[model samples]
Target: MQLLSVNLAAPHAADYTDSAGRVTGIDKRPVPHPVLVTAPGPKGTGGSGLAGDTIGDPRHHGGDDQAVYAFAREDLDAWAAELGRELPNGVFGENLTTSGFDVNSALVGERWRVGDAEDGPLLEVSCGRIPCRTFAGWLGERGWIRRFTQRAAPGAYLRVVEPGEVRAGDRVTVVSRPEHEVTVAFWFRAVTTEPELLGRMLAAGDALPEESRERALRRGA
Candidate 1:
């Protein structure tokens, strides 16, 4: 697979949620140069793992488990067709717009070597992105959260395992795939709609994000 674009967010004033007049970085755009990728510590202290990018709200958006976000160009096309509007590479707030990648179907903990074998950063699939009021407001779509949840195609959030530089057109290679059925799509469905599937998410093991893993543990995972 190829990295179609490397997107970075810019802070913009948006009064879309209870926090009136808050700045948000949901509208990310493609950049021209290579960007350094590294683990941004933890969620509370860390922001976007992409060197120049910053998380507007660290309270719920950025952390080690969600250091990077990836969305497939195919998925974006599907959404465009469904929404009857053109959706660009980074329109969905994803840092990486991937081509020919099945991002949603990736197994939790699956590893990818981005760029090259020797110099690329290694990334591990962590979890599916959950929709929030900020996202819904950014899209200006009615019942956006409900609609996104029903679609069950939320893009995958990944953690940086090895730090390196990444840029547009870089190749993405799957370094490893753990034996598991807990895919990004399935996990999103289980956590949002089918609480029954919560217990099964544990099969993903430590690759699963701490937040979801804890919930699964409470469910006797």
Candidate 2:
């Protein structure tokens, strides 16, 4: 798939509102490159205490690569038109925006390579949907979380396989797929609705990360 837009967030002050009212954290800022590394605490170091969590669970503020959105090529023009700009800046408050890929079909353990054969980059990423309020706030729509999950385009949470520079217009290639037929949407369903599938995923082995396995086991038990 072709890259639509690459976004990033440095460290800016913004209002983070929750049950405790508004607490300020780093506001979302755009970055020059596609990849962004955020830690559980402030700055880009330290592990988020959450176990087996990919995007949410408080370990990551924005998480790895934080924002990488993908869309179908056919919808590109329409999406651009709707956003009032060539590309949307804060649609999901993402760092990267993409098109031409069926991102929804990606499974939890899928890997993707960026760039081209001659000069390209490789990133193996795990799939996970943006969680509720965090995602909703980004979209500026209260129902965005549900809408996104229902749409099943669940984007992805990425980790650097071989760290490198990636920009908009770079090519994205799917290098491999998980052993099972399960997809990102499937995993979302399994986690929220069918807790049993977590165990199934763990039993399937290599299909999921070690952290994911532990969480699944706990949920299943």
Highest TM-score: which candidate? 1
- Per-residue lDDT for 132-185 in model 2, tens only? 664456446546566555555555655555545566677888998767766766
Q: lDDT of all the models against the reference?
A: 0.91, 0.51
* TM-score, one value per model: 0.96, 0.67
Reference-based lDDT, residue 49, model 1: 91
Badly placed stretches (over 4 Å) of model 1 are: 17-21
TM-score of decoy 1: 0.96
Overall local distance difference test of candidate 2: 0.51
lDDT by residue (tens digit), candidate 1, 1-221? 99999999977888874432588889999999999999998887899999888677887888899999999999899889988999998999999999987999999999999998677799999999999988999898888999999999999999999999999999999989999899999999889999899999999988888889899989883
RMSD of each: 1.4, 6.0
As a whole number from 0 to 100, the lDDT of residue 130 in candidate 2 is: 49
